[model samples]
Target chain A: MADYYFKTRDLKVGYHGRALLENIRIDLEKGEILTLVGPNGAGKSTILKSITRQLEILGGRVAVGGKKLTELTYQELSRKMAVVLTDRVRPELMTGHDIVAAGRYPYTGRLGILSREDERKVEEAMELVNAGGLGKCLFTSLSDGQKQRLLLARAICQEPEILVLDEPTSFLDIRYKLELLDILRRMAKRQGITVVMSLHEIDLAGKISDKVLPVKAGCIYDYGTPEEILREDFIRELYGMDRGSFDPVFGSIELPRPGGEPETMVISACGRGIPVYRRLQKEGTPFIAGILYENDIDYQLARHLASRVIREKPFQEISVKVYEEAREAAFSCKKVYYTEIPWGTANARLRKLLEEVKGEAGIECTGLQEQLC
Target chain B: MTEYSFHYENVRRRGRYAFVFTVMILALLLMAVININTGPVKISLKEIAGILFAGQTDGTEYDIIWQIRMPRILMAAILGGALSLSGFLLQVFFHNPIAGPFILGISSGAKMVVALTMIFSLGSVGSMSSLAMIGAAFAGSLLSVGFVLLVSRRLHNMSALLVAGIMISYICSAVTEFVITFAEDSDIVNLHGWSQGSFSGMSFGNVRVCGVIIALAFLAAFLMSKPIGAYQLGEAYARSMGVNIRVFRVVLILLSSIFSACVTAFAGPISFVGIAVPQIVRLTLHTSRPLIVIPASFLGGAVFCMLSDLIARMAFAPLELSISTVTSVLGAPVVIWMLVHHCINS
Candidate 1:
């Protein structure tokens, strides 16, 4: 028998005849906090939902507590497992208590009425998530952090032996994110429940999770301790975020590529966004831009080197859709410089576009003296 | 903070609010009685007491008070509670406040079948109401709720589901319009009266059928507090908490449809009570907990409908009025008041 409390063997999950994830294998045991890390749309959530029986498994079997997932009813599953999804609505009318009571659905009788023990479980769950103060607060009134905790309390009230969460820290501030991850880690340890969560924050996931499941390229790539897989290359490829090179520091899975505050970002366009991209290639800078009309030599150059662009005719009259795209690109940069032959004679609307978003992106028009003709 | 302390606080808070809700229910019952007794005849305290206790009845006035008005008044109260409570449940199930019984086409679905029976039923007077109710209930429930549930499975957002539900209602209306012209001239009168909706035709017999449905539907909704409350957080979380979401949603829509069918079968699709009343209750009570909102809505709906029914009958005098037109007149301003009040409070 496998020592793992839950295991997936070569799991492939799909819905509506479309495959979401394929060929994945991993296992987790009690008293473990396993964090799943990947960018959005990477099938991390699909994997979690599959295990929770929220979605059907297309070709693989998920076994929890040594039983096939398909075998358990929702009530039966609730006895051994619980899950929290990132999609949340703060219904304006419900106090935190009412929200928590819902977590007892599995235990309640056919009418789904609450008993004293169910109420006790609800209280216990709220206590576990540190959302006790918000019990009286209307869900709509609670702040992002408080609502997140309230949702966690609602899940804990179910009192399952295993809990799964999808992006529990997605929109949270840094302080709250850390606080939430800390709470999750403590729950797994204190209660000996298995905790599986998907996190965009690899740094947090590394620090907290007992086992880190890094999903990528339609499969769970690695599942082990954080010290075994939080490599610099691993994080970069998982999110397509690149700011550092892989440096083997403490051990096999450790890469301590130094951090000294976010470097000042500068974007170039007319290939203006491109050369600056190359210029800062040696140093880590975050910038994204894309194709300008071929008439714009700088934009052509940018078109060559840019990672991707919202490219279009450079000087044509803008439609609402095109204008919106251009507006988004202009505002995406921290500071933009129109560094080509700074032709001050750009079209009137184009100049206005530059001005309107100048405050937003902190654009400084350079090379203005460069002749237009 | 640790998880233990958090749940402790939420549970305590729920207890406090439950107590407050119980008080509100009592207050609603008192208001219901007051509204039930007040009317155009303006029988003073002594005369009203004599009519009830001393049995000093003259034929004409006795018929007006006992036979004509009381049944209508009670119908308003019962149907009001039933429709509004059903609206609250449907709105929660779809997570759309605007997703009322009529908007989903359930009421009209019942109407179409009732119209069919009124036009061409095999039997005459004695069999018509029961046959129409069976046909209305089957037609109203199957299509409206089934479509809502089916479409909801495809679309995730509450607003999106509401849009689908509304569209279904329009399609049903078009079909019902096609069917209306086929009825005989006498059946047309009955169809028209039923479609406009009235408690005026209701007697002790009509009340029995409608009242039992209201009671049974309220009981179903009351038993659903746990699942209904789960919907507040959202479907995703509800699933994670081990709720059989498909089953919960189906049952809620079924119960709401039955309530909608009942109202339409007997009283016609008496507008606004279902849609507007729940929203008003939410505004006044300041909470959306279905446990609180559901029962409160039942009482508030009853009281408002009773009061509105009184105005419909006597406001124009001699010319009997359609209850639906009265509710519309009464409903529109209440909706406006709620929106404006909400803005002010916020």
Candidate 2:
């Protein structure tokens, strides 16, 4: 029981027990964050709703704190878990403070009047989400980000051991997205709350989730640690992405590279080549990038965007073999763009390669902005 | 800083409740006094106060006040309060402010059933029992509620639902008219005025029975304010907050039907008090919190109905209007205003 604080066995979930997704299993320890990432209509929200008891599970056994969810009454379940759903609520004449205070439903008396301690909890929850300033404003009048924070404050005030959210970051700008996920991460660590949520932003999911669940088709495509599950191939397969490539290390996705062969060459290092690659990709021109160490920041993106890549070992001197290959590729290209790749002693050979490429015909090396325009 | 603003809002909320409740209660008292004083006999205010407070009997005035005016005024207060509360419950259930027993055809259904029971009994036994009337009214309320629920399964739009309700109301009224047209002429003379709706001719027995039922139903509705408040956020959130949505919804419908049925059983069918009174109360209080709005709506309804009943009784002495006539004239404008205001804002 201590090994996994929350676990699901062969969970089957869907509307009307028709089983849109089946045979799902999850094992999560206390204080860990698990995220579901997938494309639209991929059953991510269904799984979250089923686990939180918002939707009835078609078939499964979910046990939280070693007690079966099916056996727990709503009152008991509410004390053990709280959920932030994606449904829009437009309650009339209610302030943000009143909305958050409603989270103490399980603890409040029959009339739901708040006690002194309950009020304190509401305040603390609002403060935790940085939404205390919005306490007096009508909920309907709040901006999208402020409303999301208020919702988080409400969930926090519930004081549950586990928190479940479905697309909590939807409709929020980047700042609010980061702020909301950061608050969730802090809650999980500081309060030992087990978090299970679905996010459309895969990059944020990969960054904050301790366990990543890839939901697609009709079942769990993959479920494991971020390092194991968030890979270039896995993301592409899971989302059926035909238009972009995902970078696992940076947790970012790039649109499909230009389709044709190399028409230009860019000599860059230490991430300077990334902007040039993006511009050329946007303009639909195929290009080559080279003379980059295997571990350089530019190589991370160039590997996906460049038609041809010349790479050498990391932390090693520029080898004559790779340098010759790069010089020949640069000479064959019609234009060469240089994007101020800083040179160091270990790669002193790049200067010689640049000088040699300058003597070639039909190939001109210039600054990236001037050459592109 | 947050604490300061929260406290400020709390103070403002309390102030609003105090002001609205005080104003409504005062209006209810004034209307009750005016209703008693301004009949055909024209009793003075001094006489009314004396008779009401000191139990002074002045023969004809005492007879009028004790036998007719007192019972009618109490019934107006009780049934009117019941109607408004029923409307508030229906609005919450349907998530539409325009939902009310009269507009939703619930009162018309009850009116039809009561009319049928009366005509059947008049032919057989020449009389109708109060219990039988109430029972028939309850059954009719449930029937109409059942129809609305059925139509609701196919129609999610609020205006479409109201249109269905209006159609149901027309059918019931038509059937009632058909029954009246075929009935004995003697019965039509008595049934005609009642069918049109009035607060006249109420006895102490009606005041007592309706008083008890409306009181109990109002108490039950008041107790349910917690769940009602949670439900205003919508069902999914309410369920997550530990409310049992299925049981809560059924109880809401049952309570609303009972309240409206009591009003129809006693007063035939009063229009617009259910929808207009609650909306006015909410607008005045500037809050939709069920805890505050339920009781405030009850008081507001009492004031609105008592005044409407007074106008129905004295606007053209010896040629009194139906209670619905006055209510429709006064309450329809408020309802229209709300609709226009809602459209503009939304």
Candidate 3:
């Protein structure tokens, strides 16, 4: 019974009268950002288009601001909501300013000439998106990232209660993607503009969205806070990832671990083993990584790239059982590589294990040769 | 700082628009004067001015100026403006620069229907009323536009749509030619000249009817400029801006059809004015904002048609060329250039 700024209940959406996705439910409060993340062709865009009324809804109810979606006229809906779509708009002889100014359609007079206030809004929107310098440039001449920023500016200037975007960062590079998400976050928090957008970048989605909707084939899979929905197993299942793993803590992805028996044992801690793990992964050498605390930063990546990762509990002294396990694994490998570890109470047993392994025939220590000081 | 620049850009754009409008109006007036003054019977500028402004209806020069030359000039200007506006609308509708009534076969369709009505009515009705001719032309225009829409639904490629339009034009022209060849000699004499396209022998009554139709359609198009501007961004964006796209599209087609049908009814499918004039106007104004482009296109079309009519009248001197022949020579090159330019840029 809570009053949601935007809500869709049991909605069915698709082309013609048939529903591609049904039984969909969504609830969003004012200023909240909701993101849809799914594999390609999972009907994310269809859900967006349906809510925007670009595609007809086959069943159920959609409401905005306590009004049924079907009851609001197009002009009313336009004033309440705006959208940034994936369609490539190549308007001839239009500058970036002109393109952004089109967002004032509902506010303009019959001839669509901008009033002084509307022009100011357009300018402010462009400034917000860092597109002020691009105002006079021909829209067709802009780079994909610049064009996307301008498009976002256009939607922002509409001053709607709800803003919808479908894959707004598809063509942007890393920097622009971060910049755009930052702008969206600012707009939602400062302006109280509700945002509903689909994103292909799950990492960005988890970082920026207040709520997350994971859509699967023909239905809404689940909806919750990003912390609840962005778990490693859920993301792996949502994307049907077979050859990789998702790290929920860092929102990082790692390719599948190498196959076969361990050829080398790498002993490192405090973020030193990541590069060795990656190189061995690239060379397709099956290796075991070990004596790492379970909570070490390197263990996160090591779990996905090493054939086996031997570990001890965080802040605990290495037990005899664990040390025995590490020693056995190290001796079984053809080669042993160890990095200098700061001697500590918890991992004092590792120093002994490494010294014993150094006496063996095939062992190497990095950073030992650079210790002139 | 950007606010000041935005204002400055707006002022500069307005100034450019003013300059273009002034030039188009001046050219239109000059063309009208040349069309009135230069013919086999050379009426001096002073005499032509007197004849036009002094209300002198007593002499042979007055008769020539008032009766033969005046109506032809007015028809050329009015129908030319209408044709160009029609082309601009079609371009907006199809999102293709090359889309126009003549190129899309709507004009040929109108020409075919008018010719059939002329032949059939020559025996029974003796002569067709201007209203009847426009009605027939409108019907033909809708038919061709309908077929184009159907084909466009299946073929999303620009070149393929144009090919379909050209094929429709060929079919209509073939039908008209077949109908013309079997007609009586007197009907052939009237149909042949009209089918070739000319501004000759236009009555003041034809001028009055077409003037009213074009003026009304022009007003309707002007009022719809806001939605048309939104539409230029593409359909989904336009709809998001609250334009009722289904209704807007239908009204656009209906208005464009009315304008082109009025032109074809009076002037018989004058070629290239529709496609060439809007493109020229957009290039000159350096904006396709529709609020300015619509009126500018109308004026550009009027000037272009008046110039083409002038050449048709005096180029051979008494062995006058068809208006279509002159327009084709001038307008076809613009089209070719547009295609080449589009290719290079894309």
Candidate 4:
């Protein structure tokens, strides 16, 4: 209990005193980034709001730095925790500088005026987020990406030991999303700021979070390192996603493979077959992809988008049974498209299968074209 | 290099605030002089100065300047500042630019109770004390504010909130009118004048009472500028910044109610100044940092009301228009302009 910088014990959180999620537990060392990933409206924000004391905790306890959360005055808590909320802040007539300077609320004097040192800190935070030029811009006029950056800068300047953000990347584009996560990562690792935030982008969450908590169905489904919690089966069940597949290794999502038997056979190696598989998937062509090593990058995607995948063990010669299976599948298809392959010894058997299928009646074989024509 | 730019921006902002305060103070002083000078009896500025500063009081000009015009001008300035500050607080509380004492029906609510007290007290006791009238008005303001809060909880739309406020204003005004219609003929004369809103018939005593209440409330509000600034970001952020929101909200309601109630108790329900002055101040200052906006709004409100009172008195000289008529004429356009400008921007 004392080892963790922030911990929640048997916490129940919800709205209006009704528990939406119960028996939740969280523990983090100083500077550890804990991300909450869940299906929409699965009580991720409820837990966050509870921890921040924005919403009252329905039951149990939250402690920070060994002090009970309920025991800390808002002033004491404010110095230790700052939040960037999902709520849109439309402060009239305030500049980006004014907005960021608000982060010094706890430290400022009676009137909240920024001193020279406070101004320097504001500027430094802005520069840290690459928002130095935005200081003069009106907050309402900035693009969503710019606004998100300024808000992050606002949180950064607060100098909190624990920073809580609710979907900080919701409004940002990919570029800003990556930039924001990178800043959060750097802040957590270098400055040792503990981060607790909910993210819609689970892939990005997995990359940046030290620990990922999957919240679902009124409780924490699992809480562990991203490597432990973000498995394909768990992610699928966590989101109740039946139509598509999530790739844990590459963090890629693929739509459900097209229905029906194979109409085309794709022969490829390495990563050459990815685009072909995607194109075929888009066209609703249930294709067979094969004669590749299990360790190949294409194999990862083929398993998702291909109707059937024929494969060889990594670093092993293509077995006779596998080649027979590939030839049979190729003959069954009307067209066989083979990408340009560097035929090493292990995959030399694939070249023989391609030759046999060439010039066969009703079995058309062609080199993969850019257009997939 | 970044530090240099930030320093420059900071200095520039300070300079802008200083320039605006200087301009508003000049306008306030100029308007006060003009309001005193341009009343029915043609008191010259030289005589006015002598009567006001040099204590040369022996003539009718002295009576008009000291007794009639001085109290009226002071009432306009004090109540104007109070009303504007009330509106500024409401705007911050609601996170809506259009929210104000008059628009939210808070002033009308205060007016209803004050009107009821006036008629009943006139028939029973004789005259109402300034404190009693303020107390009645404050109760009424809170009642109306409570209703508005209820409506706001159910309907989160900005237009719906405005509609609810307008409906509340209509209901309160109707009740006040119903009470006024049954009053004695003599009471009607007094009630009619006040119900329409005016700065006339003010005494130094009224001025002192209102001045003290407003000054104390203004000081309290100024002291709260730090939390108010935090709140401008929104409730969640404000709370995270260590503002005890429930307590802060109650205080905001109480202070704003005290302000509008004081105005309604004295000058009836002066429209438009509450909503318009703060908006104009924010635009002129180009920032809503409450520390700056609170004082500036107070001063701006003072200037706005003084100018409006001057117009009300001198517009058709000797016929004296109601203050609300002039303020609405001047202020409604500013509100419209703000709405249009806000729409285009957002």
Candidate 5:
């Protein structure tokens, strides 16, 4: 086994007698999918191309399997590596089978005539990507998602040790995006191929990646695990999205809206409220919760955990103990968000407190549209 | 027996029967006959075939069918097929629909060599035609390929590759102009007519040489079809599928250059056929699969060149027109019509 595996040392890529990217360094080990994440124009694709030797390296070096890439013959380099580009030229009439069969070219004759063994490899590759049924489908007719898979299948047929994908999931819809990554994850683990890719989906990257490289401003900040790299602070720094939230329930990181102000007061909802709570927790934003039945989800969730909440009957007025409890947490804050609650005469005292919030802090009172508040 | 049976079949996996390749061969056969039948001296089609098949000709029949029209007809077919196949290969390699052999300055490279030979009046008197063409085309085409290779050494972007080709073509064009401007009037006239292109003056000897060269190139291209298909998607994708792109591009340059340069040498620089035939074939087939496009364009070009030669010879009888003028005049209008139709239909 090669000890170094793969690494890029101070690599630069250029075109038209000009440099497109400069001073890049990257490394990968077996059983790791190192995803390069960056904003558009941050040279994410440039790094992949240089490493794969699709683009020439100007300043530094790329090594694969302990050999300098430039020193290797085209045959030697191809056996050690494969690549899936975001976009490329395709012949108008090629079928999916023909596309996949191309990957076996390095192993085939000078004329590119596929032997039976080559044909078998092609079949296996298409099967691995679940694109076998699309073998006869025209290249021009394939959906973007299908075409992306066909590209991957072609790479697989090469039987390379390192699989490099450039935004492999870009053309896929939500479900197919995950499906593609699932295939990559399996390829890395089962085949022991080192997988490298650039992806746009933050949460998906956080979930599946064994290594995360956050490329920002031409500098690579590598976080060794998903947990550390998926940090709210890290995302905010990269995307300038300070208000973004990694939703615990949906398992999604919602990017901060362009000009969204953080809530002055965060109201609590039960099951899906954990993400909002986690965001507030990270920022040290204070909050209050109430409508406590004995073992209620949010009220009990609030009491024993952190923050402050009022415990009382649903129809009851703002009783002294509960009022005192709520007032104590709110003493330092000006407003309360009474969210999605029914409005009625039974909640006369609660309305008074909400009315006072409007009077003192000019906060809009909510939950008045429903009957029981 | 086994090999023979297998060869008798289409040989492609999960595609149509081998009938397509066979039909294309048959089409080429019929076009070859038409090319041989029509020329300056009227020879009946049956008599022409009989003279060719029986291997005997009386003086008048021999001069008309065997000697006069035979070489020009064969030259048109060989050069036409060669140029078109070269275009098909190039368009696939570049992944640009409009890309052709001449786009990379192969013709200019050959032209430069031709110009050098013509200006200096260099070479043996008997072999001047052959030597000048072979020398000029080989020198110019190799130089252009070298330029493209050097650029590929530094840049990975295909668009950047395209830019390098266009720039080199410009440089070659500039040099050719300078060479022509300094030459004598008689040399200038021969060069101009040659550059305009024709097949009328080709002797049997020149035709035989061109046939051998085009055959070698076409065979080389035939073996390259699958890899070229992979290239159609992009170089990176082609590479991932085990293609050694540097090797492939070098071979492709040589193949396209051989075909294009031969046409320039024998028929002059018949520019538009190399660009247009493949595009037309692509539209007619409704697919750009090299397996089909390669042979289709070859046959199509043979027919096109023959037909164009006929029209040029007839349209102004007893007053010969340059072959390039006819192809361009016909080719440009058809291309414009096709583009408009493409825009309208699509």
Candidate 6:
């Protein structure tokens, strides 16, 4: 029974009898968060809609709690699954509390008057989402972040075994996006509820999801654990991004390197070169960086943005080969900017090298800030 | 913030509902008494009360009280409530506050069929039963609903849907006019007056039938408040919350049609009561919850229609105006104000 708490097989979905995606398969355990990530209009929403029964499935079946989704009565299905859609439901004259309480629909009596227990659950859900303070405010009057939280609160109050959302973070600010995902993580862990959602933030998706499904052109491209699927090549191919680069290790994105030959050499270490590298990238100046250890903090940016990087092994002294390369590169550049590089016994040679370059190259030392201004 | 305001809002909401209900009920009773006492041949309040409570005495006043004013007032109240409920349902269905039975051409559909039935039956049998007229009106209402459903499939715009509805209404009215011409010249005047809408000449039989049908519809609507409340969030969320959209939509359309059809069969195509009354009740109650709005709208509709009926009868003493004239004069401004407010807010 626990093998696949929610499963879909050979699923096909589309509008007006034409399939947009086909041959899809999903199998999930209880309490797992499965995230769908892809470029826009890649049928991510269509797949989510199909599994939640919002759109009719063109083929195949979804089974929840061992019952076929199509065969179960709506009431029975609702008790097991809940959804927060992207549709803007601007219900008039309803407070946030009223919107959340509407999630108790299946549990309430015929008239949908909430019981005392239902009220408690609603409060709990709001609290969990950090939306307890927003309960009395009108829904339409709330900010987009507040509305998204209230929607999550509403879905939480439903108390279903499975929850599905479509692009839940689209309208949220950075803080709210992180906070909402945090709440979802806690809910998934503590309540043992399975979550399926499409997210535009691949970095956050990779962080939160137990499994990641890549929605791509006309089909399910791949499905696996985030660690296996979130590679640099996969991210590049998945989005078909021509410009810019995605760093899988840091989950950071960098714009394509400036399109020109090397003009400047940046001398810095111990994370000091990051800002300088970014300024150079923005100024569209191709540059060379470092005789620093490979594991240095600045190495990450320099590796992506710099035309050439002079490197040494981590925790090792600057080698003769690296020093020769850095000195030559510095001389070949028009100007050189120096940033604070913390000196220690192992890497004291960098200061000597800098002094030698300044004398031979006839470049005067200037503060990095003065150079930027 | 959470602790203090939550309880305060609950109390405020409850208090507002209480206040609106009390005011509406009081107004309804006041208008009923006033309508009963003030007429072409005025009667004293004492005599009106006596006729209502005590057994009827065989006199003109007694006949006027029991036979004429009582049924007319009751019909206005019952059918008005029915119309408002129908409007509320249509607004919910279309997600537009201005949508109503008349605006959707549902009442015109019912009116057309009832007119045809009246002409054909009068020509062949010289008379038509009230039940037969209601049945014909209901059939016409469904026919218009079917066409609207077809239009809804093709056009998603609310105003476009209304344009289609208005076109359908004009076509139905034209056909009704054509049918009335086929009847004897004597019947043309009657048909024209009836089609213009009136609350006069309501019989006890019409009152009883509309009363039962409307009572049942009200009960059903009230019972379905849970789904209606969920539906206010829109179709996707409603379905996620266990509402079967296909079934719920059919039920909504059928109930709204029954309500408007009943009103049309009894009182011709009354305007704006369906759209205006529910909105007024919602604004007064300060909530859109179905449980509260449904009952309040019925009472609000009753009071509004009664007031309009009274004004229509007495505004030009012995020169009674059509009921639609009063309702439109009162209702159209509110609709316009709502449209402006809606535009600004959105």
Q: Pick the candidate with the highest DockQ.
A: 6
CAPRI class of candidate 4: medium
Question: Where does candidate 5 stray beyond 4 Å?
Answer: A1-29, A57-70, A127-133, A218-223, A246-251, A255-269, A272-325, A328-373, B1-20, B39-50, B101-109, B123-129, B140-193, B285-287, B337-346
Which candidate should be chosen as best, given lDDT against the real structure? Answer: 4
The residue pairs that clash in candidate 4, if any, are none
Q: Kindly provide the TM-score of model 3 when superposed on the true structure, using C-alpha atoms.
A: 0.97
**Which is the winner by TM-score between candidate 3 and candidate 4?**
3
User: Distance (Å) between predicted and true CA of B307, model 3?
Assistant: 0.6
DockQ of predicted model 2: 0.69
Report the C-alpha lDDT of model 5 over A1-373, residue by residue, as the tens digit.
3465887777777665466666666677776788887778777887788787777777788888788989987668888888888875445666677777778878877667789898778878887777777777777678888988888988888888998899988878888787788988998899888998898887788777888877765455654676777776676677666454554223466433222232344344333334444555566565555534334355434542334455676445557666555555444455455554345665555555555565665454444224322
Residue B30 of model 4, lDDT score: 94
Chain B fold agreement for model 4, TM-score: 0.97
Q: Residue by residue across B1-346, what tens digits does model 3's lDDT show?
A: 7534756777798999999999999999899888888788978988887787887778899889888999999998889999999999999999999999999999999999888888776552238898999999999999999999999999988889899989999999999999888988888888888878998988889889888888999999999999999999999999999999999999999999999999888778888888899999998888999999999999999999999999998888889999999999999999999999988888
Choose 4 or 6, whichever is better by DockQ. Answer: 6
Candidate 6 lDDT over A1-373, as tens digits, reads: 4479999888888888999988888898889999999999999888888888888999998899788889988888789888989999899888999999999999999889988899899988888888888888889899888898999999989899999999999899998899989988887899889999999988888899999999886756658998888898889989999888877768788999887778688888888888888998999989888876789889887877888888899988777787878878877877788887677888777888878776764654444855543
After superposition, which runs of candidate 6 have C-alpha atoms over 4 Å from their true positions? A344-349, A361-373, B121-126
Model 4 residue runs over 4 Å out of place are: A369-373, B1-6, B121-126
Candidate 3 chain B superposition, TM-score: 0.97
TM-score of chain B of each: 0.82, 0.96, 0.97, 0.97, 0.81, 0.97
| lDDT, model 4, position B262 | 97
Q: How would you encode candidate 3's per-residue C-alpha lDDT over A192-289 as one tens digit per residue?
A: 99999999988888999999999877656658999999999989888889888888887788888888888788888877778778888898888898
Docking class of 6: medium
Global fold similarity of model 2 (TM-score): 0.96
Model 5, span B1-346: residue lDDT tens: 3312222222443244245456656766776676667666777867776788877667687777766677777788888888888777666655555556566666766776676766776532234767457657877777877777688679866557757877887887788788888877777777777776788878888887788778878888888887786677777777656578878987987788788878877677776787788887766665566766787788889877877887777789878788877888867676567557545633
Models 1 onward score TM values of: 0.75, 0.96, 0.97, 0.97, 0.77, 0.97
Report the C-alpha lDDT of model 1 over B1-82, residue by residue, as the tens digit. Answer: 4434435554664575576567656755565445446555555556655666799787555665667666777787888888
